[model samples]
Target: MTGKERRARIVELLEGAQAPVSGTALARELGVSRQVIVQDVALLRADGTAVVSTSRGYSLARDARPCRLLKEHHRDDEVADEMYLIVDMGGTIEDTMVNHRTYGQMSAHLGVSSRRDVERFLDDLRSSRSSLLSGITSGYHFHHVRADSEETLDAIEQALREHGWLVPMSDYEREALR
Candidate 1:
């Protein structure tokens, strides 16, 4: 098949996927190398396809959930709690962002919508012994939380507030954190 046809199939697969599909899996399905799948995904993203890369794999943003920006702070050990609170409240932790003095803004895709996803992420982090992006900025960071409804977002915010993890920083306050 031509590259254009392969890309169209990739989009179809992502759109119909129930979970994040891996590059290897896509390549196998498309009868192409994994590099081709990766490059196709990059081109799809550059062309404005709503593809999101999570630790597990890639998925299309088919739901179009409303997103709210939240600033939070917690100990590294409590990252799971912060993530669980959101996913438990029917929200997806879309990504985490931190502003570093040198790096400006850096964000990591989380796409965590359930406890299982949280556990997997925590496990990987533990195994790799890698520092979190927020650790660069002293355990303070931001998340673009996506929820099925506004009420769900409200509940997640309330839960975070009660958990003492919500920092609620304004534009000026965020600068102060740096």
Candidate 2:
């Protein structure tokens, strides 16, 4: 199939998928190498397909929802706890971002919406040599959280505050985000 056709197939697969689909799986199904699938995904993203890559694999971005960018700080060990709290409060952790003095902003798609997702993320972290993105910023980071309604986001924010994880954004961050 042509590159264009392959990309369209990729989008179709992502849209219909119940969970994140791995590049390897897509490559095998499409009779191409994983690198080709990766390149296809990159091209697809450049074209504004909203493909999200998570620890498990790739998926399409969800429909419009109330989202909040929350600044938080915590120890590495508390990662699971924070994630669990957010998911339990009916929030989806869309992504995690950190601002570095040199790097400006760095982020990753989390797609963590359930307890299973949280456990899978932790497992991936534990099995890999890499560490959390927040580590580079000394545990200070921002989570892009989405929920069905503003009330759910408010509840998640309150829970984070109660856990002493929510933090005030710096003036620079506030301006930069805007």
Candidate lDDT (C-alpha), each:
0.82, 0.87
lDDT by residue (tens digit), candidate 1, 1-46 = 9877898899899988899999889999999999998888865653
Which residue pairs clash in candidate 2?
none
TM-score of each: 0.64, 0.66
In candidate 2, residue 99 scores what lDDT? 84
lDDT of 2 by residue, 39-84 (tens): 8887565343568899899999866687788999999989999999
lDDT: worst 10-residue window of model 1: 169-178
After superposition, the stretches of candidate 1 with alpha carbons farther than 4 Å from their true spots are: 1-60, 172-178
Candidate 2 CA-lDDT value: 0.87
lDDT at 58, model 2: 97
State in Å the error of residue 56, model 1. Answer: 23
